[model samples]
Target: MNKRSLIYSGTLIFLFMVAFLIFTEQKKESPSGVVNISVQEAKGMVEKGDVFVLDVRTPDEFNSSHIKGATLIPVSNASGSNLSSNRLLEARIDEVPKKKILVYCRSGRRSVSASTMLVNAGYSEVYNMAGGINAWIDAGYPVVSSEDKETDGSQN
Candidate 1:
């Protein structure tokens, strides 16, 4: 090949490599619109009342224990593999309200899935609680049972 042709090819290859690296680095980061936060950060946000806590766990799990003020929005069924078929959330999307929504589950995996769904649904300011309620409990944060909520409501 001619020297000029070889130089041109090498420059194009170098530019392609640079662009590929940048794209891959960005892919490694979290989804563009969703923010993953630690339990501590989540607690602070919840306390500030600036975030709407959306529990994506099953109804049984949520009734057993959940963050106070969290609205139950199960993204999975008993088998825990129906996240992609999240028709419940889809049908009730309006119930979520437009706000900074903080999503969580038992171990954080499902919350990630739900966060992506919310972002795709055009709900900006979405947050996934890293480690989920498991992390929150391990960090000594308080959780309320469904019974507690019932009693509190009855007394009020």
Candidate 2:
């Protein structure tokens, strides 16, 4: 083979190998059963009862405003010594099952961390909300404040 032809073939081979490696790595890291969904998608899931929405933000932040029906289990509260036993978590997340858990926080950061914790706890289906309540509110979804007064004069 000519020198120029040999060099061209080697370059093509290297490019093909790099492309293959990139594809394989992407497939491996891509979610299997777990899905990272948008705020609207998550809201639809919540409405359909297809997943459990978990607000991983602090209690104070959660109480101020959160997705309706979301269960609050702060990431900080669920880490380390707190997660050693099911007692505390059970009280907060009484109905959380080993099925699908959709987690979120102020942004995507805390939710990502909390999703790992849920998986470690043996929850099979874990979904991380790409953007948390901030995104939800930004999308014009309704939120219940901690001190919203109803016609009954009861705080919701």
Candidate 3:
């Protein structure tokens, strides 16, 4: 190969490597365009009342206790297949408004997948609580049980 051709190839290779590194570094912040937030941050946003809190847990778990005002949208069933989960979310997408959304589960793991599903569905500004409701409760945040809601409704 000629010296000039070798130099040109080397420069292209260097540029490609730089671009790859930059892309990967940004991906580390959030996978599939979903952001991850700490439990404390999630609490602040919830209190501010500008964000929609999504509980991606089972109905039983959600009824047991969950962040006040959170909307229940179970992401999986006993089978827990990705295809079924995606389809379920797609079917119920209308229930979720197109706004800032904070998603959580029992231990934060499931929420990541749920958040990704939301992002894939074109719902922007999605965040997954890093520690889930467990971390939120551990941080001394209060959760409202179904009984609490029932009692409140009974008085009205």
Candidate 4:
């Protein structure tokens, strides 16, 4: 082939190789241990029984409103920057048997990070709530606010 043709062919080959590597890497990352579920799926899991629900929002936000059976771990508090070692979270995890855990926050971002942490911390099944509590309310699920606490008698 001519020099110009050879150069074009080499560039095309390089581009193809780059695309292949990108696709391969994506496929490898697709099987990440963290499971992401939509608001509907999370609600279904709660109804199914045997799923551990963790709310990873701040104490004030959590107290305002939260999932009925979820345990508040608060990702900010657990990272060793806010709270002191998350004894409450550790205790809850210890008390509850190993099961599928569904984690959420004000938005989905923190839940994703919290899910990774839980998986690393030895929880076999960890799921991040895709849209968080906002989606839960949008889905028409019941959220108990702090004012309801006195009447409900339910502890976090």
- Which candidate leads in lDDT? 1
Q: Can you write out model 3's per-residue Cα lDDT over 1-156, one digit (the tens) per residue?
A: 999999999999999999999886663347589888888889889989999999887776777788899988887772343445554555787788999999998888888888998899889889899988888888878887866552221111
Provide the global lDDT of candidate 2 against the true structure.
Answer: 0.69
Give candidate 3's TM-score: 0.71
**Tens digit of per-residue lDDT, candidate 2, span 1-156:** 999999999999999999999875552222433456788878888889877778777666767787777777776653243443343343445357677788888778878776766666677778888877778778877777655421221222
lDDT of 1: 0.81
- The lDDT for every candidate, in the order shown, is 0.81, 0.69, 0.80, 0.73
| Candidate 1 lDDT, 1-156, residue by residue in tens | 999999999999999999999876562227457788889889999999999999988776777788899998877664454545554676677789789999999888888888888898899888899988888888878888886553221111
Candidate 3 Cα deviation (angstroms), residue 153: 21
Inter-residue clash pairs, candidate 2? none
- How does residue 110 of candidate 2 score in lDDT? 78
**CA displacement after TM-score superposition, residue 118 of candidate 1 (Å):** 0.6
Clashing pairs in 3: none
TM-score-better candidate, 1 vs 4: 1
Task: Kindly report the root-mean-square deviation of model 3 from the true structure over all alpha carbons.
Answer: 9.2
RMSD of each: 8.8, 7.2, 9.2, 7.4
For model 1 the local lDDT of residue 30 reads 78
Q: Per-residue lDDT of 22-109 in model 4, one digit per residue for the tens?
A: 8755511115478777788788899998798888787767787888877777666633445656544543456444788888987688
Model 2 bad stretches (over 4 Å): 1-34, 77-95, 147-156
